[model samples]
Target: MKKKSTHLRALEGKSKSEKKKIRKEFEEVKERLEKAQAKYVQKPKRQKATTSKAENKKWEQKRKDRYNQRVWKGWRDKDMEEYPVKTYNIKDIEKDT
Candidate 1:
């Protein structure tokens, strides 16, 4: 049983002084608990940032590479050999450097 419950049960048939002593002990336990809880700050909810930073960074890199592939293709020249991304792999170009 919890200290609070034990202390509460102790109150039955006790003198007024003893009841006051148990109540004081309960207050001390409450204070110690408050102190322990105050040591840690709560983190912000993930819902605020739907995606984590690393995931966002990875997605942005992929999107940039995709757009870059399209930009590399001469969009104006009407030669449809294949889509830019399918024709050239981004990682292959990066590996050269």
Candidate 2:
């Protein structure tokens, strides 16, 4: 049988010190989590106003109609042939050698 490498043997079974340290760390984390959960347990339940499906549909339709009306009002009788031109030039400057 081949002899096990030191790294494999060390990692396969943790020493007592390493186990105790890991357990302590886990316990501390658990304690913190419990405290955090306890702190949030008494928080006020938010009363979100629930609108009905019909009301939601009505609101969405009203918004869409308003948007369409505004778009039609903005573009009606506007000249489609006259597009604006860019007024500035963006040429790269020559670098001094």
Candidate 3:
């Protein structure tokens, strides 16, 4: 059999009234710990509703306006330029090669 700890031996030597007081304090601490844990437990958050057709259209228009503003700003800052499209004939290039 395992030997009892010194603390256990000391506790065993205490009077009944002292033991009862210690037991009551232990119960109170246990109850308090349970209450604290319950208080901190996370609740599920409510989800947002899906956007309606009108809301989606509004968002799309806002996006287009934002893009146009950015393009205009770039043109004003001389950061935007227009280039002419160049077309190539594959047969003509092959004949040259």
Candidate 4:
């Protein structure tokens, strides 16, 4: 069987200068990537919300007014003129309870 070469074995153990060169190259590559990323990254545009406070307040007021009008209409329809007021004694309710 053939034996492995000494040069290949020597290449497995890097010299001090070779290690330093590799470390410096890695550092340079990292710095270059950081600079390129900084240049390419973009800021997002601002978005406006759908419902502003003033519009919400206006809608809420209109809803409340509509609810109040419906309640008033029912009260008027039930009690205004055609339907006569009926009186009941409190004792009758207590007896039923």
Summarize candidate 1's per-residue lDDT along 1-97 as a digit string, tens digits.
Answer: 6456676788999999999998998999999999999889686766676789999999999999998777767753566744544566899999998
lDDT of 2 by residue, 50-87 (tens): 99889999999999999877766655547442333335
Give the best candidate by lDDT. Answer: 1
Clashes of 4: 0
Q: In angstroms, give how far residue 68 of model 3 lies from its true place.
A: 49
Model 3 per-residue lDDT tens digits across residues 1-97: 9989654565597898987887787779989999999999999999887998899999999999998877677665674444233478999899999
State each model's CA lDDT, in order: 0.82, 0.71, 0.79, 0.79
Can you give the TM-score per candidate against the true fold?
0.36, 0.31, 0.36, 0.46
Give the distance in Å from residue 79's predicted Cα in candidate 4 to where it truly belongs.
Answer: 1.6
Candidate ranking (lDDT, best to worst): 1, 3, 4, 2
Q: Candidate 4 residues 1-97, lDDT tens each?
A: 8876654444457997876776687779989999999998998989899999999999999999998777677767877853244678999989999
User: What global local distance difference test value does model 1 have?
Assistant: 0.82
Cα error of candidate 1 at position 35, Å:
0.8
In TM-score terms, which candidate is top?
4
Q: Extract clashing residue pairs from model 4.
A: none
RMSD of each: 13.8, 22.0, 10.6, 10.5
- lDDT score, residue 95, model 3? 97
Q: In model 3, where do residues sit more than 4 Å from their true spots?
A: 2-10, 44-97
